[model samples]
Target: MMMVQPKLTVVGAGPGDPDLITLKAINVLKEADVVLYDALVNSELLRYVNPNAEQIFVGKRRGCYRYQQEQINELIVERGYSKGHVVRLKGGDPFIFGRGAEEMEYATAKGMDVAVVPGISSSLAVPAYQNIPLTKRGSSESFWVITGTTKQHKLSEDIRLAAKSNATVVILMGMGKLSQIVELFQKEEKNELPVAIIQNGTTKKEKIGIGTVDTIENIVEEQQLSNPAIIILGEVVNHRNEILQVQRNINSKLTKSA
Candidate 1:
C-alpha cells in the first residue's frame, strides 16, 4: 500500500486587503482540505477557499487569546495527517510577525511535509499605503520592526535601542501598551521626537494619530487608537505630513484643470 504523504502549507493572508493575496496562496487555499486562520486574517480572503474546505479559527486578537500555541501546533500535526491538505493561514507574512517558524517546527517533529508561502508583511505595506516611507534617502536610511509582545508583553531590547537610534522604529501589536512604550522614548533626551500611530492600516477603516514622543501617549488616549495597528517613530514620520501636502497640491491642480 502506497502511504499518503501528509503535508502542511503555511500561507500568509497579507494585510487587511483581500486583493493583496498572492496567486500561489490562492491556489493553496483552493486545494486545502482544512484552513486554520488567524484572528486578523481578512474575511474576504477566506471566501476564496474551496467551499468544501473545513475552516478553523485558531487566532488570538490583542492579548485576549482563545487558542494556545501548543494547541495550534498539535492541531496542525493531527490535521495534516488526517486531512488531505492542511493550510495554516496567518495575517501578514507568516514567517515575519506571525509565528510561522514555530508551527513549522512542530509539524516537522511529527514528520509532516511542510511548505511556506510568503505574503506582504504589514510592517512594510501599512506604512507605504499611508505614504509614510520607512526609509528616506537622506532624512532616514534604515528602519527597525519589532514586536510589542516579547515573552508576555515585556519590553524588547530593540525597542530600547531604537529610542536612541536615527532609524525609523515600527512596532506591531504595540497599541495596547502605547503608554509604556511612549514613556520609554520620552524619557530619553530626544523626547520631542515625532511619532505617528496608524490603526487598521491599508484598510478603509484606517486612522492616523500624530504627536511627539513626549505627548503621543496622551494623543493615543485622546484618539483611542487600537491594535491590529502599527506605531512609527522617527523623523521619517514627519514626511507623512509633507507627502499629504504634495498630494493635496496635485489634487488641487487636477481640480483646477477640470
Candidate 2:
C-alpha cells in the first residue's frame, strides 16, 4: 500500500450558507481523506470533497450528541494516521467559538501536522444579511460578540454589562436564554431597544424575529425560533428596517412618476 503522511486540517465551513465558505476551504476539502463535520455545518459543502473521501458526522446539537469532545479528539488522531488527511470541518470561524485551538494542540501533541482555514463567522454575516450594521458611526460606535452560555452551561454574566452599554451586542447559542437576556436589558431601561433574532441565518431556512427588548421574547415564541440562531441588540437592529423603509420610499416615488 502507498504511504501518505499523517496530517490534520481544521477548516471553517462558514455560517449556514454553503456559498459563504472561503475558496481555500474548498481546496482543502478536495484533498481530504476523511471529513469530520459538525451539526451547524451545512452538508451541501461536502460535495467539494474528494469522491472517495470518508465522511463522518461528529455533530452535537442541543440535546443530541454524536460523539463527546474527548472522543472527537481521539478520532482526529486515529483517522489522521490511518487515512492520511483528516479534515475537521466546523461551522463559522473555527477559532471563534469552535475550539479549533484545542483540537490543533491535541492533534499536534499526538504528532499530526496541522493547518487552519478561517470561515466567515455567523455573528457578523447573519446580521449583515438582514442589513443590520454592528457599528454605525454615531449610532453604534462599537460591538460585542459574546457567547450565550459559559463553559459551565450557564447564562454569561457579561450580558449584564453589555446590556448597560451603547455598543451593539451579538449573542450566539442564546435562544434558550431569550427571556433572561431581555430582562437584563429591560432592567437597564432599554425596554424599547431594537432586537432581532435570526435562525438558520444566511440559508434558505432562515427565520427572523424583529422587535425590542420588551417584545422580542414573545416574538420568538410566536415565531417558534430556536438555537443555531444569532441574537442582535442595539440601535443597529433598527437599521435593518430603516434600510427597508428607504427602498420602499424609492420604489413608491418611481411608481408615482411612471
Question: Could you say which candidate leads in lDDT?
Answer: 2
lDDT of 2: 0.93
Steric clashes per prediction:
0, 0
Tell me how candidate 1 scores on lDDT. 0.87
- Which stretches in model 2 have alpha-carbon errors above 4 Å? none
Error of 2 at 149 (Å): 0.9
For every model shown, what is its TM-score relative to the native structure? 0.93, 0.97
Q: What is the C-alpha lDDT profile of model 1 across 178-234, one tens digit per residue?
A: 777888887787787888898988888998888888888788779888877899998
lDDT of 2 by residue, 11-113 (tens): 9999989999999999999999999999999989999999999999999877888998999999999999998999999999999899999999999999999
Error of 2 at 116 (Å): 0.4
